[model samples]
Target: MLQVLSSESAQEILSTLTSDPGTASEIANSVDQSVQNVSYHLDRLCEADLITPTKTWYSQKGREMTVYALATERLVVQFSDSTD
Candidate 1:
């Protein structure tokens, strides 16, 4: 979980999923990345249970696609102000 989140690409993929669920192809387009790259991170997020397949999108060619959405509503990260 922490490992995946530490990745910039994974973070970008997660940000896109936060808005709504999408297939790897869709996310790749939105993030301006290759489908292969997006698909890889999606697998990581799924393994971490951070995202899940919520729906399906079928193409005109009859290919079924899995759509992923955020399993967790929010993620907060804060840094301590202490100089020590």
Candidate 2:
């Protein structure tokens, strides 16, 4: 999870979602990135459980689009010493 969060693109995607849930294309536009790049980050974010596909919408061309939103409004991270 930390590894995923460490990415700058991932962080930007998360920030974009905070204001409004959107499809990969919309996120890419907001972050000034390519759709493929944003999609890759979105997949990682989904795997890390940081975001989720809230709904599905169809484009005018009959393409399926998934809207993503943050899984939680807030996140808290804590570190613990493994060696005791």
Candidate 2: C-alpha lDDT: 0.98
List runs of model 1 lying over 4 Å from the truth.
Answer: 76-84
The residue-by-residue lDDT of candidate 2 on 1-84, one tens digit each, is: 999999999999999999999999999999999999999999999999999999999999999999999999999998889985
Local lDDT at 57 for model 1: 86
Clashing pairs in 1: none
TM per candidate comes to 0.86, 0.94
Backbone collisions counted per model: 0, 0
Score candidate 1 by TM-score against the native.
0.86
Write candidate 1's Cα lDDT for 17-59 as tens digits: 8888999999999999999999999999999989999988899
Pairs that collide in candidate 2 are none
Query: How well does candidate 2 score on lDDT at residue 44?
Result: 96
